[model samples]
Target: MSSLQDIPVHVAAEWGNALPVLHEIRHALERLAETGEARVIDLNAMPFGPGDEDRLLGLLGQGEIEARLDALGVTQIRETAVPGVWLVDHRNADGERLVLHVEIAEVPAILRTQAEDLRDAVAALDARLATGASPFPHRPDN
Candidate 1:
């Protein structure tokens, strides 16, 4: 098995809304969990930006992200920051890690029906960005 140093930064996203894009984040974590051993650092929930830190704690408790990760058996670490990005580290059976970086925003009703598709769409965006390709506007394939 590879040590933590073997972990590769395969996925990452900037700060954004914890609720609007959380489903995609869960899907990413699910993909990582499927590999059996993976860790995700959720920086979106962290306090950041002007007046965003104004709240000591709002109605959106921290439980949402943590609970989802626990259900997936994926390790999750949280930090404070802007509200739109999420970073994930994925692992393979060989114990090699690949990072999955994501930029999550509100998914339109057209694409929000299924959970897996949302994940795939976001992952696709990450792939495009990594390859230095421009993202064509997402049209609902459904």
Candidate 2:
């Protein structure tokens, strides 16, 4: 038997052709700066190898916010270390990743409140106020 010291270890840094995807992300950022239009890049469409996704995610780092929504399926949205960049992951009920995308914008559109929803909320608040129900009752001071 050979000693452990005799074994040779080969280490290689592999990005798996992820440079092109990085370039695309840079271009998207430029477009957002120039036109104020958000860009979405679908990672599922790219030919990413085993370690490529890890590399890309490592570069982006982590952010402060994370949100999850369950409708027809479960959707997870997270912001990257970059201020205006967000990662959106959608998984089916079976827990399979269905969509993986990077959105370049101030905020992802899916997380934004719709005008109709806001209107409904406002109406509800108005109705509640009209009832004149005091959330806190007046207490006599001793």
Candidate 3:
């Protein structure tokens, strides 16, 4: 099997954007650390040649968190091995990819809890508390 470093990290010369994107990610990471600023880079906007995307994703590798959300369709969020770097994929109901983004932040914006969701959660918790119900179902000990 080819090692990660053996994988060339650049796109075809004419589509020379992948390596620069890595540099951009690095800078964005620095900015996020120094100031609480975050960044989102749209991968679909770039002209990536064959194998370039794979190479980039390979370099980033996989981190500890992976999340899948279904609101309209499906959105997959994953953290890269590097801290504060996340990969987000948004797909339509038909499962076609609509956008791919590299988001440099503690958590990708798509994965963050929305205000509406917060309100619903709060209301549900308040109701549960008023009813004096346990969130967990009762289980008999063996």
Which is the leading candidate under TM-score?
3
Give one digit per residue, the lDDT tens place, for model 2 in 13-103: 6746577888888888888999998999999998886678878988888999999989668999999998788999999998789999999
Candidate 3 lDDT tens digits, 33-142: 99989999999998888777877998899999999999779999999999899999999998999999999998888777888899899898787666765545763232
Top-lDDT candidate index: 3
Candidate 3 RMSD to the correct structure: 6.5
Provide backbone clash counts, one per model: 20, 0, 0
List CA RMSD, all candidates.
18.8, 7.5, 6.5
Candidates sorted by lDDT, best first: 3, 2, 1
| Candidate 3 local Cα displacement, residue 35, angstroms | 0.4
Candidate 2, residue 55: Cα displacement in angstroms equals 1.3
> Can you list the residue pairs that collide in candidate 3?
none
Minimal lDDT window, size 10, model 1: 63-72
What lDDT, from 0 to 1, does candidate 2 have? 0.85
Error of 3 at 3 (Å): 28
**TM-score between model 2 and native:** 0.73
